[model samples]
Target: MVHVNPVQVIVDPITVLWLNAFACNLTKSLSTAGSAPAPYIDLRLEAIMPRLVLETTHDYPLQRDRPSTLQLQTTRLLVCNYRSPDPTAPGSLAGLTKCLERLQAGEMAFGSDFPARDGDLQMVPDRLVQHTLGKDHVQPAPADVVASVPDFRRDLPGRLLWEEPRDVVFIHMDPFWGDFFGTSAVRHRPVPFIDAIPVSMWVYQNRNKVASVSDGRVSDLTMVLHVPSLISLQLNHFQYLFLLRQLERLSEMSALLTLDAERLLGAAGAGSQCVSAALPQLDISLLMPCLLSSKDSSGGDLSVFPDSSSVTSFQEAGLLPTRVDSLSEPLAELGAGLSQVKRGLNSFLSSLDSALKSPDDQSDTMSVMSDMSSDSDSYVLLNLELDKSESVDPLFVVEGALKRVPSVEIASEVTEDTHSEVSLSSAMRKRDVISALTLRLGRVELVHQGAGLSSSLKLNMRHFAAEQCAAIGWDEFQAKFQLRTKGWQGLDVSSPPCSVRLRMDSTFVPVANQRQHRINIREQVSSELEVRASELELALLMSTVTNLTDFIEDEILPVPLPMELYLEHIKLRLTEDRPPNNITSPGVVPLDLRLPAVHVTRDGAGVFTVQQPTPGGAGAGTGPSGSRSLVDVASSFNNPASGSEGELGRLRRRCQLLEDQLEQRRGSEQRLSQLTALEARCREAEDEVLGLREEKEVLMKTLSYLKQEFLRLDTAHSRRTDAK
Candidate 1:
C-alpha cells in the first residue's frame, strides 16, 4: 500500500501566497509616520540642502525616496570601477588602480565598501540597487545605516543602531563607454537611455584557505534580478515592443556581469589550474509596481484612466486634475498598438527560430559568454518568474532564450589518449548545461488594466569533475507543476486546473576531460497529469455549443468529469552492454503493464464510484456505490451531516439531502462570480493604497519647496508688522 503525502497537496498554494505577501510587504512605502515603525531616511536633511549640493553628493539620484526596493543577503565578491569628470585630475585613475592591486594581492576585504577609494573621496554604501524606473519613478535610497533615538526613549538615552547589510557591489562606469564596455554585445536603444547602467556581480569564493589545487568546492550560484517596471509597461501601448527591447538590454547586462566576474575571479586564482567559475543560477523576478502613476500607465504624456471605482475615489479625494469622458480614441490606439506588438513579436520569434536552426560559424563565443559561461566542465541554470495579482502567464523571453541552447564546451589542452572512447563531439552532446527546467504560467491579459498576476520559480544546476564525481550520486526526485487560469479565452474551449507530476532518480558520470555527463537511457521515469472540471468557461464556446446541439445551454454543468493520465514507468535501454558480431536478434524486451483504475464523483457530496476497466479498450465499468472515492478522503471541508446521517428520521433526512444539494449547486455557481467581484474590489483597494503611498512620497520630495514657501511668508509678515 502506498501512503499519500498531504504536504504535496498544500505546498504550492502556500508557497505562492507566502511569496506574494512577502513581495507586497517588500514594495510598501518605507516612509511611514510612526515611532519605531520601520527603517526610514531623514527628510529634514533634504529640506535644508540645495538641489545642486544633493546632486554632487554620493548616491545622487537614489538618495532619498525609493519604494520599489527589495533586499538580499549572500556572500559575493565585489569588483568596482568609476569615471571622473576631470580626466586630468591627480587621482583620476587612482581608485581603479588600487582595486586592481588589492585583487592581485588577495588582500581584498569583503567588508570594504570601495577598496579603490582613498580618504579624500566620500564613502558610499556597499550595495547594488537596480532600477527599471519610468520618467516619474523615484530613485530608491541607498542601503545605509544610521543611528536613531525615539522621542519616547529620549529619557533613557540609548542609541538604536540599524544595520542594513547587502552583499552585492555596484560599479558605476562612464556613460559613454560605447563599445569599450568589455563585450561585443550592443544595446539597442529605441527610447532615450539612462546616463549609465551600473553593473552588479554576485561572486562565489572558495572558502578553504589550505585546500589542494583540485580540491576546490563549487556551489550553485543564484542571481536574482528584480524588475518592477514590467507591470506598468503591460498597461501601456508598446508593452511587447518594450519587453523585446528590454530583453536585449538584459542580455547585454548579463554578458557584462560575466566578463566582470571572470576578471575578478581570474585575478583571485579562481580560473587557475584548469578550474573555472561556472555560469550563475539565474532567478529573475518581474515584480509589479505598488503604485500605477499617470506616467506608468500612459507611457509618456496622456493617461488612460483605470477602473471606475479608482477614478471616482481619486476625483473625490481631489487628486485628479481633469476627467476625460471619451476612451474610444485611446482604446482604438491601444488596439492598434496591441496588433503592432503582436506582429513585431511574431517577426522576432521567426527570426530567432531561423537563427537557431541555421549554423553560423562567424558568431563569436565571447558575446554569448555573458549570459552563459564557456568554461570547461561548467553548468548553467535559469529560472524566470513574473508575479501579478490577476494574471500569471508564461514569459516568452525565457522560451526564446531556451530555444537557442548555448554551447558549454571550452577547448582544453589535449593530451594523447588514443584508447579513450570519449570524443569532443560526444562529450559536448552528453554535457547537460541546463540540467532541469520548470515553467508555470497563467493567462496573460494585455488589455485589462485592473487584472494582476503573481508568480514564483527557482532553478538549480550542478557541475561535476573527477575530484567531485565521487560525491555526486543518484537521488530520488519528486516534483509537481501546477497551472491555474481564470477567464481564460480561446476558440470554443474551456480551461480547468491542470497539474503534472514526475518522480525519478537521476545520476551523472564524469567523462572526457573530467566533465559531467548525463546518463539518460538507464533512468526510469514516472509521470502523471490530472485535469478537473471547474466553473471557468470560455466565451467562444457558447455559440459553438448552441450550433452543435439543439439545446442552447446558458451555463456549463460542473460535472464530475475529472480526468487523469498516469504512466507507471518509462525507460530506454539495450538488452546487452556488449554483443557478439553475429548476433541475429536485436534483443528487446516487452514492457510489463498493469491495469489502470478509474474513479469519478457522481454528485457534489464527495461520493464516487470506483470502477474497473472493461475489455476491448472500453471506458470504466460501474462499481459498488459504497466504495469511498479519493475526493472524499482528500476533502478539506468538514461535513457536519456525515457519520451521523443514520441518526436522523426520514423527514429530517429528506430535508438534509435537499439542503445539501441546493447548497452545493449554489456554491458552485456563485464561487467564480464572487471571486471575480472580490478580485475587482481588491484591485480598487490596492489603487487607493497606492494613491496614498504616492501622495506621501510627493510630500517627502516637496519638503524643500514647503520650507521655501514658509520663509517667504515669514518675510512678508515681518515687513507688514514693521509698516504698522
Candidate 2:
C-alpha cells in the first residue's frame, strides 16, 4: 500500500529559487509513467519524504500538473515578499495577486519583508505565521532594525500591495498615533476620503472619525454602491452621535446613509454646531434644558454634554435668557430686616458675655443665696404644719377636749409608782401603735411578695389606689373593708370547691358498699359471659354444619359413582340407633353380603367388581365373583337428560354446536354476497361483448363497400388509358 503524508514547507528568500527548481524536476519525473523502474528506486527509501517548499514567483512548481498517484501533498503555501518599482502605483499588487491565484492548493498566506529598506515601512512580525512555521524557520531581522514600530506608522496596505477587489475593508486607526489617512491632522473635520471603496462593509477601528461628515457635504459626496446588496458602515460611540447630527441637518438625505452603531452610549458629547444641527432633527426645543436638568438632578459630570461652546451656542440661538430681572423694594426691605435681626442677636450675646465678667457678680450671688434661704424656711414651715395635721387623730382630739370639761376632771391623788407605771404603759401603747401602722402600710407589699405578683401589676394597683381612692363611694369602701377583714374567714382559697367536694366524697364513702357494688357487678358480668359463650357455641355449630354441607355437595356428590352408593352412605349414617357421637361404638361389623367395589383411572375408565362375602365374614371375598367395566355406566350418563350432574355437560356441548352452525351460516352468507357481485360483473361483460360484435359487423360492411369503390375506379382508369 502506498502512503500519502501532508507536508508543509517554508520558503524564504535564501531557498526560493533552488526549492522551485527541485519541485519542478520532481514533478516532471513523477509525471513520466514507467520511465523509472521500481527496482531502481527502493520503495522503502523513497517513502522517506522531505518538505516541498515553493517560491512566490511566476515559475513556482505548482503550475505544472503531476500524476494522481504521486504521494506528495502540499500542506502550506508561503508567499514571499514581492516589491514593485513604483510603490504608489496600483499595478504593483498584480504580481502578488497572481502568486496567490497560483497557490490555490492549500492554506495560502501572504507576508512582507520586515525592516523594509525604505524607512517609511514599519516591520510588524506576523505572529500567526511565526507560531505556525516555527520561530527558527521564519527569518529574523538584523540588529540594526528598530524593534518598536508604531501601529499608525506601519504601511499595512502599501507593503502587501494587493489592491484587488475586497468583500470587506478593515480600516484600523490608532488613537494615540497618527496614520497616513491624516485623521489627526484636522481634529474637527470628518474623514471623507475613506468612502471611495464600494465594499459591502466598511469597518473602522479605535475611533469613528469618518462619521463626522456634515449633512450638506455628505449629500454631495458619493460613497455607497447602488446595488441591491445591503451596504453597512460601522461606527463607534462618537461617530454614532455625529451621524445622528448629520441626519438632523439633512433629513432629506437620510435614505443615502446606512449606519450601524455598536456600543452606543446613553448620552454623548457634541460640539455647538452638532447640537444646533440635532435640535430640529430630534424635534425637542428644550433638549438642552432637559439635559441640564438631568445633569443637575443626577449630579453627573458636565462633560457628558458638549464643552462650554454648547452653552454659548444656546444663548446665541436665543433659547436662553441673556439677563436676570431685579427684585422689588419690599423684598429688599425684608433682606435689610433680616440683617438687622442678625446684628441685634450679636449685640445681645456680647452684653451677656460682659455681664458674666462683671465684678458685681458677687452681689448677685448673695441675693440668690438669700432668696434660696427664705424658700427653704417656707418649705420647712409647710412640712411642720403637715406633720401637725397628720399627728392629730380625730378621736384623740375629741377625747382630749372632753377630758378638759369640768365633768371630766381627774383627781391629783395618784402615787409616784402609779404615775411611773402609767407612763410605761403609755410608752408601750405608742410602740404598738407604730408597729400596727407599719404593718397596715406594708400589707399589700407583703401580699405581693408572697403571691408571686408581677411588678407591673403591683405598680398598677398602687397607682390605682392613689389616683382613684376619692372616686369610691362610702358604701363601696365599707364593703371592700368588710370583705378583707371578715368575709375571708369561711372561704377556702387554696383549692377549687368542686375538687374539695370530690375529695370529701372520696373519703366519706363506705368501703363495704363499694365491695358489695363490685360483687354485684361481677355477678352480672359473669352471667353475660355465660350467655355469650352459649351464643358462640351455637354459631360454631352452625358454621360446622355449613362447612360439612359444602364438602358433601361439592366433593362427595360430584364423585363419578352411582347415585345409589351416595344414598346408601347417607342411609347408613341415619339408621344408627345410638347417639351420633356413639355411632362408632360397634366397630368393624362384617356380613356375608355383596357390595360393589369401584376404582377409577386417569383415562376416565372405571373398574367395578361385585364382591361376594365369605362365610368367615371378611370384608374381601376369597374368589373373584364378577368383574365389569364402567363404560356401560358412562354411556348411560352421557344421555342429555340423564341426571342433574350430566345436565351442565350436555348444555355446554349444545352451545358449542350452535356456535359452529352460526359460523357456517355466516360463511355461506359471505359466499352468496360474493357470487352475487361476480354474476353482476359477468352480465356487464356479456353486454359489452354484444356491443363489440355489432360494431365489428358495421365496420366489415364499410370495408366491403370501399373495396367495390376501389375496383370501379381502377376500371375507369384503364379505359382512359386505352382512349389516350
Candidate 3:
C-alpha cells in the first residue's frame, strides 16, 4: 500500500474553537517516535467550560421537554516535538523543558485567544438554562443506556456540575510499540469513526469529532439545522456577503419594507401581487422585537428576548464592539425588526378597525389571514439551537517548537532488543501532566510526534456545499448532536491495535413547541421502524400465507390461508354468477375475506317460474259444483288466492309420510353416533399405547448405555489394579 500524509485539510478553517471548561480531565501524555507504525499517537483531550447552549433535535423524534443541550466529550490527539537535533528521536516528557511548555510560555503565538463570546467569560453552569418551550420534543435517553451512567439520575437535580477540558485526545494506535502481538493483516484497526457515524454536526463539537473510521473509510454525513437555527446563521452575515442568496434577500427586504407611503400603508396595490415577496432578503434581526413580544406575551418563555439592559448596543463602532459577534448583535437586529413590524402591523390593524366601523366600508374579513406576522419569533427561537453549536473549525496554527532533547545510545551499546514486538505496548501508555491558562478564546494549534508517518493512519472525511445539499425532509431532520455513547468521552486500549465504538443519537429536537413536539415524537418512532426494516432487509425474513379462503382471522394460528385458496373461492363465485362464455382464470378476483354467511341473500329483482297444483281432496274446482279448480284457475302464480287446494292436500299427505321416515332416520342416526363414539375411544387408546411404546424404547436405550459404561469402567479399573 502506498503511504501518504495523514492530513485532511478543511476548506473552511475556524470551524472549531472553544475554551469552555466544564470538566477538566488531565492525563499523562504517552508519546514516542519510531519507524513505520508508531508506538503511540499522542491523543489528548483538554477541558474547557462547556457552553450552556440550546440544542434542537432536527426533525427527528423528540420526547416531551428534555434538557436540550449538546454535551460534548472529545478524544483529541496532538503532535509532539523534541528539542534534540533529530526531531524523530524518542524524547521523555519527564519534567525536562517541554515543547508545549515553551509555546505556552510565549515562545510562540497564533491567534492569541481562540474565538469565544467576547465579554466576561461565564463559568460553565453559573447560570440557569431557562426558556419557554411549547412542549417537550426531546426523547429521554434509552433506559438501558441511562442505567450505567452516574450523571443521569431519575431526577436531574441541583446545579449541573460540568468541568470539561478545552478538548481531549483520541487516536487508534499501535499499543504494541515493542511487542509483535496482533497482526495488521488479519484484523484491521478498530475504527469507531467508520462505525460511529458523525451523522449530525454538533456531534463534531459535543463528541469532539466523531468518525466511523473502518480499516479505511469515512462515511458521508451532512450537517443539519432546524428552521430556527438556520435563520440565526443567515442573520449572522448581515454586514458582509459571506454567503449568497440570504444576503440578497436581506438587501431586498431592507429596500422595500423601509418605505411608509400612504398608498403602501393602506395596501391599495394589494390584489393578485405577492406580499412579502422580498422576504428572502429581509434582515432576520428586524423580526425579533415586534414578533417575539406579541407571541409569548401570554408571558411564556420570553427568556429568548434579551433584556434591554442586558442586550449590548449594536453597530456603534468601538474596538470591543467590532469584535463582539456573539448572539447579541444578531439578537439586537432581530429585536429592532420585531419592533418595526409590530408598529407597522399595529397601525395597520388600527386603520383597519376604523374602516370596519364605517358602514361605507363593507370589506371581507377573509383577506387578513394571508398577510401579517413576521419571522422574529422563528428567527429568535432558531438562535436557541444555534447557540449550542459551533461552525467552521480552525485546524491549523503556525507554531513550530520543540520541548525535549533525547540522547540516543549507539547500536553497539544496545544489549537487549527492548524494541522487540513483545514490549511495544509499554511505550504507548507513557503520559504527562501539564497546565496552561487562556487569556481569551480562539483556535489554538498543537502538534505531537508520530511514527515516521509511513504506515497509513488517516481521519479523512467528506465535505459538501451546504447550499447545494438536499435535506432529509423536515420530518427526518434533528438539529442537536447526540453522543450515542454517553460519556463516550475517554477510552484507552492495549493496542496491538484496539478499537472503540462511538455511538451517536440521530437528529431530534431536544426541545420544541407543542405542535412541533408531536411531529418530532412521531419521527423517532419512524426512525426505529427504519432501523428494524434495515435488519429485515439483511436477515431476509419472509412470510407465507396458507388456506386463504378460510377466513378465521386466526392470528398466530401457526398458519395462514393460501392466496390460491381464496382465489379459488372468488373464482367459483364469479363462475356461478356469470354465463358459461365468461369463465376466466381465478387470479382476476381478489380473495381477501372475513367470516361468511350461512345463506346468501339473493336479489329479488329477477324473474322466476311457478309450479301448478296437483289433483287431490278439496280441489278448488269441482265439476258442476261451486268449488274453484285451483290447478287450472291460476295461470299466474303471482296471485295468492287462486292457489292449488288439491295440491295442498297432497302435500299434507306427503308430509305425514316424511314424518314416519324421519322417525326411522332418527333411530339410524343414534346407532351411527354410538359407533362413532366407539371409534373415537379406540383412537384414544391407540395413541396412549403408542406413547407407552416410545417411553419403553427410550428407557431401553438409557439402560443399554449405562451397562456399556459400567463394563468399560470395570475393565479400566482391573487394568490399573494389575499395573499397580
List TM-scores for all candidates, in order: 0.18, 0.13, 0.13
Writing each residue's lDDT as its tens digit, candidate 2 over 492-549 gives: 2222111000000000112343322422211221110000000000011121223234
Name the 10 consecutive residues with the lowest summed lDDT in model 1.
464-473
Q: List ranges where model 1 is wrong by over 4 Å.
A: 1-189, 192-630, 633-638, 641-724
* Candidate 2 Cα misplacement greater than 4 A, ranges: 1-645
For model 3, what is the C-alpha lDDT against the true structure? 0.24
Kindly list the per-residue Cα lDDT of model 1 for residues 1-724, writing each as its tens digit: 1222211111132344355445444434222333343322321100111111000101212111111111111122123222233535211234333322322232112222111112211111111111111121223433553455563455432223322212222222121111111111112111111111222222222233345233332222222111111111001112222333333333333323333333333332122111111121111111111111212121221224333222112122121111221343465477557656755665576457545642453232213223354555553433242322114432222334434565455544343322322111112221211111111122111100000011111111221100000000011001000111112132111224322221111112213432133222212111111322112211111111222242222122422322232221222111111112344655323233233333333442335444322221111222344333555544413564653443355458668889999999999889988999999999999999999999989998799789999999999999999999
Q: What is every candidate's alpha-carbon RMSD to the true fold?
A: 30.7, 57.4, 38.9
Report the candidate with higher lDDT, 1 versus 3.
1
Q: What is the C-alpha lDDT of each candidate?
A: 0.27, 0.25, 0.24
lDDT of 3 by residue, 77-125 (tens): 1222211234333222221223223223321122222111122111111
lDDT of 1 at 671: 97
Q: Which of the numbered candidates is closest to the native, going by highest TM-score? A: 1
Model 1 local distance difference test score: 0.27
